[model samples]
Target: MTKQQQDEPPILPEEAVADDSASIGGSSTSESQASLRSSILDYRRENGRTYHRMSDGKYAFPNDAREQERLDTVNYVWMLTLDGDFCLCPKNDISAKRVLDIGTGTGVWALDYADAHPETSVQGVDLSPIQSTYVPPNCYFEVDDLEKEWTWSTPFDFIFCRDMNGSFADWEGVIAQAYKNLEPGGYLEIQDSIWPPVCDDGTLKEDSALYKWSHLLIEACDIIGRPINQTNKRPAMMEAAGFEEIKTTRVRFPISPWPKDQKLKEVGTANQVQLVHGLEALTLGLFTRVLDWTKEEAMVMCLEVRKDLKNLKIHAYWNGYVVYGRKPLSSEDK
Candidate 1:
């Protein structure tokens, strides 16, 4: 989940380059590439739609009832980062001093953080005040926007942001805000995925339907002046925002359980199961109105996308880049 300009998160230190070179290895990806992908982002789908209910986007979570299972499922895979050091440290190691969770949808991560680390204070904020009212003593959920000037008035040692992709209009500003709000030597960790670029053996044809269909998101973000392309810009932007010691890693799940890597296959299949339930709101609400695709078409093609997820040998993967860096201690900066 992420702020605006999410979905296609910016580049990690790897997977792509800031040069916007349009070429990788000996083969250039731009010239004669036949693919219409943007230089800003590689092939990916955007996720994180929890804020739609409050705003004018597609679907709304917690309208009448909360899809607690769906929200928690999306959060479980990345629980690795839910520690003090990793940023989700509630009910985890208490080494972390403080944390701020941006776009905290269900307040699940924040509550978990607070529970795990009773000594640490954690705050979760969203455009919608739809999260559970019950929370850990160390955790609190509020209604706030990461982009509209942070009002917390307190600096934190770690900033946790998820699933605000559709709600952010200025991602760089958000990152800069994280930099500003972080205590020196604090950490920032993020996880998100909703863009789609399937690679069956890396041979999914350029003309493949997914290429065109997934672009609906690209177009929609463009119209809104936010972007699905924000994923690829993290490392550089973080560096520019004045973070250091940056490291980036990628995790990919096949759309289904067809990968040779049984773990990824399992992950992909599990993720796909979740997607089956969330796909309509993700595409129809997130992209349809802007892209003008009908509910029937989205329903049909997304099902195909689900089928592709489990196609064992497709080598198809959607990647999430995990990166963390310390806010430079002012003395260290000198």
Candidate 2:
């Protein structure tokens, strides 16, 4: 990272704050709410999908309503897959005084955590301002790019991030920033799905459109210096960042409803819905902008990929990894 990159400022202004009346259930709208909506409308549009114009092309996916719905569905499915568990870290049972959630899409996890632990102060930051206007008293939302320098005033006891694929060009920089911002013995948890599904039964053919889509998207991301398949390498990166007692857990997430087990079937069913709903939002920008595909051509390819996502006989699943580590209690221990 260059010196300028290391010193990059937050995405939002220092005085920017979420509107308290903008919560999902609230109907009141303030000046801040109108400002937030106008800011979101300023995003660049391509093929009916919106991209973050302020991010300087660091992130590829849209931040529009359709994309936000897909993100919420993903969070819902993850909660169901984990049997309602929020954090898988061993220290989850401990009451954290301060928590920071990076890339907090819609602020769902942060709100839930704050509601569950009223004593904790939770701060959620993201590149988009789509979070609810009404949030808990103990929970707050900010618009900031996590790839830049963190200007938080205090260290956090726990830091959590999810589904941050294709958002950061330097994974090690993010890990190192987390290490620097965490209090001693503080824990960091990251959850993400490995891009490009794997099939063990040979049902997902090499010529399948889903396989082609993955290859094209991965290639596009690689050309942009951000690889989406970094979930498996997170443990090593965390270890290199001076974190201790690192742990990683992997879960198989089916692309369709092909699993015989009830839980797996449910997960696959939910995933099928998520993939189908998000196919365009996930690929339209990348394919059209980076891969030189026309909008119609991209839509046709996405349709083919959606068909494969709903095919029950495919028996394909992506690896979802949850990795966590703790900062040492003392400098000597590190």
Candidate 3:
């Protein structure tokens, strides 16, 4: 593992410094509980899609049913990338006490983990209340933003975050908060794909719409204040947050089923499906709102990008990173 140079620290947004109030708690009477549920279900509709109303414009992706399906598909792709492992960290390190899943969209990972380890209590937190009601008894869901201060009464033994590429304005602050909210000798694992994908062969030409779309999405996310290329810099950030035994693994996720290896072909096939399903969800808002592109124009661009993604000739792939670190044990424990 090569040491990574830290990028310039991002400025914390003023809006992100609020209290870590959870949306699941604080309702006393039944009437107030019903009112809270109503407010939480009040989603913002845009361009035929729905997003979380609590932190409007905070996350770029949609939270509607279509996006939820795409998220589940993406989860499968990540699991394939990990050879069906739920996590890449040392299995022994994850305590059977408390596990926290940050940005747990749809709560699939949390629910699965809870079902697998019945002894462990799992909590999934997200800005959207789109998780299903029929979840494992040990699993819980909450609507909360992680950028704010964390107020959980107990520290987590394992904290997991995945695919939160463009979800935070202050990545460092969130990592520090995770460190603070972790039990000593706990583990924090983050799995994310590096964006603006790289191509080894010349097949992914610069003139390709796929190439242009990738870079434009990065630029749009940057203009909107949540750059998606933060995956590569997370190790250094984790190190700076006083985490020890940091480990990072980068795997190539092919754009199409063009790989000769059977394993890579399977990964590529799943990735292609999710990418095709996610193009509009990932691009529509950014293109129309941030880049000043019209709705029709954005749709056309997505169409063009779809064509490029379907072309098996383009040897395009993203570098998927799974980074994990251990919060140091206290002096007496050592």
Q: Quick one: best lDDT, which candidate? A: 3
Model 3 residue 189 CA deviation (Å) reads 0.5
Best by TM-score: 3
Over all chains combined, what TM-score does candidate 3 have?
0.90
lDDT against the true structure, per candidate, is 0.58, 0.80, 0.82
Candidate 1, residues 1-334: lDDT per residue as tens digits?
2343254443221122111112111234445442422311231232323333333332223322234566666676555322223443221344467777887767787877677677888877665555676666677665444566665566888887765555577777888888888878788876665465545335455555455556776677778676665675777888888888887766564555555444554565566676666655556554455666666787787777555444444444566666667787772321
TM-score of each: 0.73, 0.87, 0.90
Cα lDDT for residue 12, model 3?
18
Give the per-residue lDDT of model 2 (tens digit) for 53-139.
556477888888988888888888898778888889854577699998988978899999888888999888877767887888898
Worst 10 residues of 2 by lDDT: 10-19
Candidate 3: segments with Cα more than 4 A from true spot: 1-28, 92-95, 331-334
Give the Å error, residue 158, model 1: 0.8
Question: What is candidate 3's local distance difference test score?
Answer: 0.82
